[model samples]
Structures are given as C-alpha cells and as structure tokens.
Target: MGSAVRIARETTEQVLAEWGVGPQEPCTGPVLLILSELVANSVRHAAVLSPKVTVIFAGGPDAFAFGVHDRHPYRPALYSPAVAGSGRGLATVMELTLELGGSAVVRGDADEGGKSIWVTLPLRRSGAPGAR
Candidate 1:
C-alpha cells in the first residue's frame, strides 16, 4: 500500500507538472489524496495473489481523469463512518471528487474478473466542457 501510494503521488505530480500546473495549485492536494485512497483500496480489497493494479491519467484541455484498475470483480461498497474502516476509501474519493466539481464511477468487468474506479475533475473554476 505504501509503495502504491508513493507511485500514485509521484505520477500525479509528474502529470500536474506536465500540464503546466504548479505544485501549489489548489487541485494538487486533493488529487493526490484521491489517488492515495483509490490505490490503497486496490491494495487492500482488490488484490489477487501478487495484486495487479493499473493506473491511468488522462486530460483534456479543461478536465483530467484518473483511474485505477484492480483484479477483483466485486463492486466496491460504501460504509457509514460508524462502520469503522469499512467505507472511508470509496467515500472519501467520491466526496473529494464532488468537492472538486467532478464525479466518480466504479465498474466491474465480469469478463476480466476485476474492477476499475475513476474520478474526473475540472481544470478550472469556469468548468470543463462536458464535466458533471
């Protein structure tokens, strides 16, 4: 989990820099947090043997999308805070995604026997085209 988190953070930083977004940019922190949660979840609940996790980062002129694919077919579940460590991962990802004027989705591919969670955030306050 720690290694995965570090890789995700480094990848996000590289991407943001490549996008010409400075490290102090407002979205950098939330984006790193979101990536950590998603990657951690993959390591914790979605691992199969060696645990295969694939992360992708892509962006348009005004929005960026990040996703993590794991080798677990089960759909992620959301737990109330009272449930202890049960629900925070997906919930935090969703909350931060919305806070950034973005949204999240998780899909399980039966054929592949795994799932991927994705979040999309706007690049600017004016909003990204087709962002919801």
Candidate 2:
C-alpha cells in the first residue's frame, strides 16, 4: 500500500505539472493526499483475485478531477472523523475537496461489478474573482 500511495502521489504531481499547476498551490498537497487515500482504500478493501486498481486524472483550465477504479463492487464507507484511525479516507477526501471549492462522488458499476470514486478540485486562477 505504501508503494501504491507513492505512485499515486508521483502520478498526481506529474499531472498537475502538465496542467500548468505548481506544487506550491494550496490544493496540490491535499489533492495528492486524496489520491493516496483513494488508492489505499481500494487496495485495502476492494482487492480481488487480480486486484486491479486504475487511477484517472483529468484537469481542465478551471478544475482538476481525480478518480480511482477498483475491481470490486464495494462502495466507500463513510464514518465520523472522531473515530480513531479507521474509516477516515472518504471523509478526508470530502473535507479537502470542500476546502478547495470542489466536490467528491462515488459511483458503483452494477453491470461490471466495480466502483469508481472521484473528486474534483477547482483551480483559483490569477485575477479571477475568488482567486487566492
């Protein structure tokens, strides 16, 4: 899972760079963290015989969208953050997305028996009304 997290972080960094976003951006760290959590959760809870997890990253001039797909039908479990160390992945993703003026969503593929969890983070461009 550590390797998975590292790979996710590196991939996310590359994507952000390609999209003209810098590592110093306020949303960069949280976006990387969110990617790590999504990959870790898929590995921990959605593994199967092959245990395939696919990560997708897409960014437009205005926002970035990240997604993780796994070969299982399990939906992410949501829990109170007060709980110790368990069930905080999705919660953290949601919190960070909201802080970045974005959103998170989970979709289950009934026909394919798998799921994809996604988050969108808005970009605060220079000179925009709410730029930061």
Candidate 3:
C-alpha cells in the first residue's frame, strides 16, 4: 500500500505539473491521500495479480479529471460511511470528490478486461478550476 501510494503520489505530482497544476494547487495533501487510498484499494481488490495502475489528469478551467486504472473488469459501487473498513473506500472517494467541488465514477470494461475509477476535482477560488 505504501509503495502504491508513493507511486501514485509521484505520478500525480508529475502529471498535474505537466498539466499546468503547480506544486500547491493540484498537489494538496488530502487529495494525495484520497488518491493513495484508491490505489491501495485497487492493489488489494482488483483481483488481478501483478495488476498495473495508471494515472491521468485532464481538464479545462472548470475541473480536473483524475483517473486510475487497474486490470479487473469489476467495478466498485458506492458504499455508505457506516459500512466499516471494507466499505469506506468508495465513500471516502465520493466525499473527497464532492469536497473538491466535482464528481466521480467507477466503470467496468471487458474490452480491456479492467476497471477505471475516476474523479474530477475543481479548483477553488483560485480562478484556476474548482477546488482547493
């Protein structure tokens, strides 16, 4: 989990930087933690051994779309916060997504035999995009 989190954090930092999101704006701590959690979940439950995770950042002024991919066709459903450890992943993701002033989705794909979980976060009042 720690390794996956580090890779994601590094990748996000690099990708967002390339997309014009500086060190402070798109690379916030809570956002990093949320992504870390998502990556960890994929590593544990995507059901594909040696599965790889990919990160992509794309958006305009209104929002920043963050995506993570893994080698499983199974998609994750939203669970309530009261459901305990196994259920908190998606809930925390949704909370972070909403808190960032944007939306999120998890989709299954048989075409590639994998799943992609994504979230779009908006920069706050920075005139940049959606959240802070």
Candidate 4:
C-alpha cells in the first residue's frame, strides 16, 4: 500500500508536469491527490489479477482529463461522503475534482472485463467552481 501510494503520487506529479499545470495554479495538489486516490482504489479493490494499473492523463488547450482503468468491471456507487468510510475514495475524488474545477465519474463494463474511473479537470479559471 505504501509503495502504491508512492508510485501514484510520483506518477501524478509527472503527469501534471507533462500537462503543463503551472506551479502558480492550485490544481497541482488537488489533481495529484485525486489521482493518488483513484489509483489507490484500483490497487486496493479492483480485483486485479495482475497488479498493472493503467493511468491516462490527457490535456488539451482548455481541459485535462485523468483516467485509471482497472481489472474489475464493477462500477462504484455514489454514496454519501458523510458515511464514515463507506465510499471515501470516490468521495475524496469528487471533492478534489470540485476544487480543480472538474468532475469525476466512474464507469464499468460489466459485459467486458474492466472499468475506468475518470476525472476531467479544466484548465481555464472560467470553468472553475463559480465561473460563469
């Protein structure tokens, strides 16, 4: 678990750097933390027969989207964040996404053998929480 967290944090920082997220921007911490949590979820409970977790980090001129595809196809549910530890990972993701002016979603292919959880973070400040 500690190793996974380290890998996830390092990978996330590298990804954010690649995405051109500036040091002046507040998205760095939130994005990295969100990425870590999502990756942690996969490592902890995705029923991955293999330990490989595929992470995708993409950014355009306006938005950035981070995705992690795991082995299991069971989509996580949106539960109350106040439920003490029921679904804290996804909840933390939601909070971080909100802070980053983004959104997080979990989708799974029951027909297939995998699931992907994604968060799209916008680049511009106008796309942020109170932006019009």
Per-candidate TM-score against the hidden true structure: 0.82, 0.84, 0.77, 0.76
Against the reference, the lDDT scores of all candidates come to 0.76, 0.78, 0.70, 0.72
Give a tens-digit lDDT track for model 2, residues 1-132: 788878888988988988877887766777888889889988888776328889988878888998899878766544345523565667777777777888887787778688788788888755566777
lDDT of prediction 1: 0.76
Write down the TM-score for model 3.
0.77
lDDT of predicted model 2: 0.78
Put down candidate 3 lDDT per residue, 49-122, tens digits, no spaces.
53677776777755567778887776666544452455677777777677666677877666867877777776
Model 3 spans > 4 angstroms off = 47-50, 79-85, 110-112, 125-132
Candidate 1 scores a C-alpha RMSD against the true structure in Å of 3.9
User: What lDDT tens digits, residue by residue, belong to model 4 across residues 3-107?
Assistant: 777887787777666767654566666677787887887888864563778887778867778788887866776445453366677777776677666877777
Candidate 1 structure quality by residue, lDDT tens digits, 63-104: 788988887777665333542466666777777777778877
Evaluate model 3: give its lDDT.
0.70
In model 2, state the lDDT of residue 85: 57
- Weakest lDDT window of 10 consecutive positions for candidate 4: 123-132
Pairs in steric clash, model 1: none
